[model samples]
Target: MKRRATALATLLLTGAGLGMLTVPAEAAPAAPTRTTAVCPTGWGSTQKTGTSAATASLVNIRTGRHDCFDRMVFHVPGVGSSKIGYRVGYVSRLYQDGSGNHIPVAGGAVLEVRVAAPGYDPDTGKATYAGKVNKPLPGVNLTGYRTFKDTRFAGSFEGDTQIGIGVRARLPFRVLQLPDRLVVDVAHTWGTAR
Candidate 1:
């Protein structure tokens, strides 16, 4: 009986040792990684213009942000006692190096904005300005404003300033979208420069 008991204890010890050998040591977790793009604030204003035509000029306006943002908004305050039309066209251009190498940047979706006053029209029945052909308008033109948002501009920014095009047009205008550019034209009005 004692021999049997000793043999059982030896077996138990050997089994315990084998179990210990099969266990794996815990590994320390890897250090956390930092991943983000930092943009700047107050980059001032940058403006560009396209070739002039009979209707209106195409302009590009960009504002600098201290930090990178996913979207951009344009604010057009109402022009009191002014009878004119207001519109905006937006586009994004990729960055280019001085050496002629182009960096592949994501382009923002096209956005077009139009403004008109409610309950006011110089010509109520017709599109032609026959009665007031030489006048601005009969009443105060209640101007309107709007904002559009765009994403996918990440990692393509050189600084806090965003890359985009702004076109403020008069009336009876059209925006032509191309594969890599946009064109806007206006008639019978004037657009204020910002």
Candidate 2:
């Protein structure tokens, strides 16, 4: 029994001497090897514009969330194969069209979205969106939105419509033109959109 005890002690001392049985005083946290490069960074905050002669009327506005960005969709009813044009850019301040009245948008940065379409029926002259100016968009519940702070109807005048988007900051954004809708996506963060 004494011999076995001695052998065990020798083994332990050897292992310790060889630096193979050492324990750290405090365990260090393992570093994460994962990356968030999946988020896109090409979309800039500069003014993005598309040119088209399509004449549509803005009918609705919608919002959705993604892993990397928050999106806003504008519904414009146009004729067959008609393309919508728009000018999306970050502005120092948003203003109401025709009246030049200052519009208050809640966020670190504001976006002035000018769509080449009116927000009312040209024939009937009836308002289609029906959303009031300087108020949160109707039916758009931004309860848990990460980037979106507020949205308001700037105004529609002279066959042109304007909308204001309030984001967390002046981050990268992209614009998309579809057959009858326009899309705008704002990234949540600079590097990792999560």
Candidate 3:
């Protein structure tokens, strides 16, 4: 009986050692990448390039103009402390067909406004903005992907991704309240941006 007990204890210890050896090591996550998108800022389907780098984009649902406006007056809902910037131009006038030439907008529309913070890419999904010296994004009211009608589009400023976060409606009207102000619409993309 004594011999059997000693053998059993040795076997148990060996089994425990083998189990630990079989454990797999944790894998490290991939590094984040930078990206951007386009916005008309109260314009009508006018996408301007070379704007500020944004990780996401928002468009009005009712209209396909990539925003809930026809001119630049919409404010960035929660970007009060974000130090937002802008640039004025007419992107709607420059159109293109399959030939890649500057054509005209179908309804003779011209997006006259200042674009601030270019749009975002939706491929990467999200980013980790809370670590080390890089803190998370501020409390901007801009919804993630909920405001737009595109189900395939991921919305809002989620981390450092290129997802759009604004109203995606294509309307022929413009915001009159602040024609020169770009109000960040917290409810721009509805609940989709979150």
Residue 57 in candidate 1, Cα distance off native in Å: 3.6
For each candidate, what is the lDDT?
A: 0.29, 0.86, 0.33
Clashes of 1: 5
Tens digits of per-residue lDDT for model 3, 115-180: 343233246433222111122123323334333322112212322212222234433222322322
lDDT (10s digit) by residue, model 1, range 1-194: 99999999999999999987774556545679776544333322222223312121112222222222222222122322232233343334333222333233222233233222211223342222111222222221213212112222211111111222222321233433332223333221222221
Candidate 3 achieves a global lDDT of 0.33
Query: Which candidate leads in TM-score?
Result: 2
Candidate 2 residue-wise lDDT, 1-194, digit = tens: 99999999999999889885565657656778876547888787899998866787888899999889999998987633677778899999998988999999999999889888888888999998877877778889887999999898887888878989999999999998776888899998878436
How far in Å is the alpha carbon of 29 misplaced in model 2?
Answer: 15
On TM-score, the stronger of 1 and 3 is 3
Each prediction's total of clashing residue pairs, residues at least 3 apart in sequence or on different chains, is 5, 0, 51
As a TM-score, model 1 comes out at 0.19
